[model samples]
Target: MYFNNNLKKFMKENEISLNQLANICELSINTLRELKNNPSHNTNLSSLVILAQALDCSIKDLIEDDIATINFEKVAEKNKNNRLFIRQQVFSPENVQYLRNLFLQVGVPCNISSYGRYKTASVKNEYELSSIKVDFNLRVLDLKECTILQIVDFYVSVNQLLLNEAVIKDTLIKAFETYARKLKLNQIHFIIDRDYERQDDQYSNEHSELQAYFTYTLGTESMLFVQNNYERSPFPELEEYQIEWRKTLS
Candidate 1:
């Protein structure tokens, strides 16, 4: 189950606007805005303490349990014997060039080679999705050693060109599900980076750069955050915020 902030309810009971609360708590409005918009967003513990104090409530009262329960055991049993078909093949020069061209059309750049092991699968409408990139690093403990797979990159040039955001999300979920089942793995993870850039001269309009890490269990519809860190980590160059996800294969 997901736990969300009770900021809205607290504010309503106190008859205070976001700005008023921000001023009272000595917090920037942007932080409050993010909290209001994203229910699953992990707010800092300090901020939560401040908010709870200001609202005259316990920290527990400021959090609401609204997520559905997951049955990990049942899911594990369902996928216990599955295995993915992976083959190691070198990509020809012609194939590499073809992939580069396709990614270019979608504002994504890439280099393809035959050096890495690849997993190919079919998505919606029998659309062939080949050369799915898998990263073996960034291992998590929930999955057995050397068994965890991180989908570092995936590209569907055709879908990128033709599908909308909602459809694309569904397709990706389906792709993850297929991989988990075939690979006989319990969990899969995704790391997405959103760049922050200024378009106009106004600095206030700039949004903070963020990284979203997601973990999906096989046969589940929701993407849950298994671990998330907002403070600086060892890899500051990569992201200021870190998120981790873990899904059960059962």
Candidate 2:
């Protein structure tokens, strides 16, 4: 497929120079230039995956034949239908808007809803049905409905921005601290483990920041507090976390 318009669309949308894209995707500037100049020659799966991840999009979006323009009316209609689907689920206002943003990001039209926290989605696209043979593919965890346990171990999806240890430490520590105080619980017992994989080759995956935001949203919710010692965790609070760096469905 031709890469000129598609590549340029993401480049412009992300507002990054060629050099920056090259650096982020691990493709050399010369390679990017060559591809841009010769759009039809040799664009492959690996580079496409890398580029899409760097630009925060799906591979389908990266390899589209042309940049599809967003129609306001169509978007409005889709969102209206989506809102209906969400309302049918009887979720909170924040959860309804969250679903809206999910559809808007992927630009795919879907109308299904599920109930409860940490459950399989009620709707599955064709790709999902025929793709994975695993027992589980997707899940959503609602911090608001989560029980206050002495310790919680959960996984987080990492994005391109979370590359260094310092950044990871600062990011997680701040989130834990904020939510701990807001929830009136000890920081040590909450969010004791963090395991992350890179958010590549997937659509509508939740990341660390989004998870943190979910935790923050539950700040005002009332829950029983259960305290645990730092010994319960693999490492002490505020210490470095173990994050596995690999590409998986984000």
Candidate 3:
């Protein structure tokens, strides 16, 4: 069963109680009790916020594992002599499992081996997701490792006249640039799969083209936080933030 025993473990380590957490999160006592007793249930976003705030951890840290898998195209090319570096979303077991599968499948030829999950000891900036816990580290591929274009998903929405596919893409590019400038992340790229539909012109202003859609990596960390705490919240900004990540890669 999906159990967030990590929550209890963390609480014990921190010497915190449910009552104390409730006060810290401004949540009702019953909510905290529910979390302590049954954390496996589907939690709402606000509830996640409450728990995360109380524990000073990421929402992923408060959850249990989700299922994931990966497919291999070919055997690994590189030998086991090289070191692997990874940066992924915090508290994302699904992604971890996917990477695990991918590494095993690809490493079949080179006899490459994978290292289990470990802590991110070299975090340059704690301000960047400092609250996150239980990050995954895999020693199978180097930062220069490149994978074929498997899939790209684009999450876009044009609620106002300003946001559109072009604008959204541009905003993402700008966000990446900001991160590259601030965090010195020089090598990063993206592949997007977009799903969009046009609404009846009568239903929206002529400028309002599309409704809403989302794109995410199957097993990778998003560029939403390229810089310190500069997250891509209210993401897919359809207006004013016009930048292209593809350009930088090119």
Global lDDT of each candidate:
0.42, 0.38, 0.37
If the candidates were sorted by their TM-score against the true structure, best first, what order would they fall in? 1, 3, 2
lDDT of 1 by residue, 119-143 (tens): 2221121211312211222222232
TM-scores, each model vs. reference: 0.28, 0.25, 0.26
Write one digit per residue (lDDT tens) for candidate 3, span 1-250.
Answer: 3234246656787898877777777778876677667654444667777678767789777665532111110011122222221233211234334433432332211111222322111111112211111121212112464311111233222233333434443453454344333323333434432223332233223333344222222222234424323333244564233221232222
RMSD after Cα superposition, model 3: 18.7
Give me candidate 3's TM-score against the actual structure.
0.26
For model 2, where is the 10-residue window of minimal lDDT? 213-222
What is candidate 2's CA lDDT for residue 220? 11
Q: Clashing pairs in model 1? A: 2-67, 75-250, 76-250, 83-182, 84-182, 90-114, 91-114, 186-249
Candidate 2 has an lDDT of 0.38
Q: Which residue segments of model 1 deviate by more than 4 Å?
A: 1-114, 117-146, 153-162, 196-242
